[model samples]
Target: MNVMEIRNTLGASVLCAVMFIGITALPATLAADDDAPARETATAEPPDPRLVSRGKRLYVFCRACHATEEVKGSKIGPNLAGILNRPAASLEDSLYSDALRQQDFVWDEEKLDTWLLRPATLVPGTSMAFVGLPQEANRTAIIAYLKTL
Candidate 1:
């Protein structure tokens, strides 16, 4: 496919995700499903290629604050290189909110899902201003893409 075709396909895919997923910014406390609980694994498995592709597309939205590259450095949020097991508020360059700095847990899949569902709710006064990804599929896909980085 040529450039125009690629753009059209990407546009359609984004439209579909937004429309079908019912992606909304609801309060995490309200939308979080305690039962669906993200499972914790000792070692993370490679993400499905298809899911990673979908997640890379979804990550366009997150590029505003978060950076997947180390050389790129921190933007509005911290650089996410090897963030899967990183501690919260540990980045040296970025200024973190008191809410986030107080946290003592590593970023495992379960924690990531919980945090991405609603960042503000997870760390009440976080400096990062993102509302959050409410769709479970979206969260899974994005998390998958993050793993690749």
Candidate 2:
């Protein structure tokens, strides 16, 4: 091949290699990293089955006060059937503390994590009696289960 032909072939080969690497590595780069902070996003994809299963088990702790089913009605806490993305203290029937009512924030995964870590810290004077889930894994599992509700 002539010099120009060799150069053209080499350039095309390099381009193909770069494209292949990007395509193959893209998913890996996007894969969930456990250490990364959790984010709440509306997604068409189904929740992770393993995470959901673990979360369901962890949710037993929350079941005493929070009812996930609307038909069950509000227990000690408001009906949490659709709590994710909901604004704080939006439930009219469920009496909320002034601390929670005065605030203006949506319940997203990150906020929920912080809340689960320590409700008192998140909202002082709030009525939630349970101390908090100290373990990050437990909190994550419980949050995952709550999302499914």
Candidate 3:
């Protein structure tokens, strides 16, 4: 082929390759926006402020044993700062009762509610000796407060 023809063909091939790459990358760029729908649906309901406030007051009891900080060895109980999203008894250094350690549950709202209502009944042989808040409203408030931490 003539030099000019060969050069033209090479340039065209490079342009096509670039265009193909750009097209493929478009989907990845768009994928991030897809999560917006999930987030919107997940966030439709706002948490109750009253419950959260009351729970904050109740959390005074928890502050004695647990802390909310991510730092290690901060308190007598496990650092509860991020307890909402974490699995039960999953804290690193805190010594847990065999019963609590063996439990496979995560600290979701329902589970926390039951646990707050009756700690020993929820998990038999647990080392957390404190009896739960007797009132359902108090327990619910505590759970709400814990979620905010």
Candidate 4:
């Protein structure tokens, strides 16, 4: 082969080698991207049954002060029997805090969770002297139990 032809062949081989390396390396690059820790999957899991049971057990602590029975004017705190769906300050004959009575809010899971986390923060100038449940799991359990009420 001529000198020019030989040189051209060598250049072509070098180019081919570089391309092969690049192509082979692409999969590993892609795999690294794929293998990166997966993003936390957003899920709405049903409330744990054990949590609900535990909440029910813990609720006995509250029962002395707050009656779960629907019969109104029967406890230190308003009867919480049907509190889940009720309006925030709609309890009749129950002296709710001025702050709570002024605010228009419905008691729901989300609101309950926040309230349970910090009652004073959730409703400023509230009369609920009991400090809120701090642990998320316990709060969730208590909320589940409250819903059953």
Candidate 5:
């Protein structure tokens, strides 16, 4: 092929390569920018019906392991009835990890919030297999629903 023809072909190939790269990266760049407004922002909304209902919906996963029963014990996890204000791992029948059972604190809102964010982090060696609710809104919803139990 002639040098002029080769140069024109090479220029076209480079242009296509650059355009392809830009097109591929555009969506990811825009996605990051779209989330910028919400980054590090707290929810202005208080615990409302939407949050409670959302939490109730989220609680379906917990139902497999726990029950709302006060006296009847759960096989997978402890009964969560009246969990708020109750001491951690207070249920005598269930097997609680030493880290959790030794904690000398009640299941208050603040504590529950932290725990639900990451159960293993809150109590290392705890038996809970849940990774955690990373989303603040989801955690808030779950905690609100827990209050109803």
Candidate 6:
């Protein structure tokens, strides 16, 4: 092969190696950055069946306005398949209240807990109509179920 061709091949190989290393090391690098938002695991260990079952039952209240799966798409609320660690009101298509869209935050467990306890309390003008889950246990179960979705 010509020297120019060899040099180009070597440069391409080096770029690929750097990209691979960067991609593989991303999680560790992100973990060490205190300012970075923590990444949520999508392949977490299976949630307890009992907890999921209870949550599914409790989710009836949510089902009226929300759809969990994407194919079912957004109803009154947005699809929640990957809600955990997601930014508030980030979905491009779904309509959100000014109160919710104006705020900035990721939806972690604590936030979800508070949101479950009281939607309006979390985002005063959120369009969601469900009053709130007064019981912590019920909220926990529902969160667990949501993680599976």
Each candidate: what lDDT? 0.84, 0.88, 0.83, 0.82, 0.87, 0.88
Between candidates 2 and 4, which one is better according to TM-score? 2
Native-to-model Cα distance after best TM-score fit, residue 139 in candidate 3, in Å: 1.1
For 34-88, candidate 3 gives per-residue lDDT tens digits of: 9778998888367799989988888887878877767656566778877886888
TM-score each candidate: 0.68, 0.70, 0.68, 0.64, 0.65, 0.68
Worst 10 residues of 2 by lDDT: 34-43
- Model 5 earns a TM-score of 0.65
Residue-wise C-alpha lDDT for candidate 2, range 12-45, written one tens digit per residue: 9999999999999887777755324454344345
Global lDDT for candidate 5? 0.87
For each of the candidates, the C-alpha root-mean-square deviation to the true structure, in angstroms, is 21.1, 9.4, 10.3, 11.3, 14.6, 13.3
Candidate number of the best TM-score: 2
Candidate number with the higher TM-score (2 or 6): 2
Alpha-carbon shift of residue 19 in model 1 (angstroms): 61
Instruction: Indicate the residue-level lDDT of 22 in model 4.
Output: 100
Candidate 6 residues 1-149, lDDT tens each? 99999999999999999999999999888767854434344445668999999999999988978899878878888889899889999887798889899989999989999999999999998888878999999999999988878
Model 1 Cα shift for residue 29 (angstroms): 53
TM-score, structure 2 vs. true: 0.70
**Tens-digit lDDT string for candidate 1 (71-112):** 988988889988888988899988788889999999988989
Task: Tally clashing residue pairs in candidate 1.
Answer: 0
lDDT of 4 by residue, 46-123 (tens): 567887899999887678778886754547677888778789989777878789999898899899889878889989
The CA lDDT at 127 in model 5 is 91
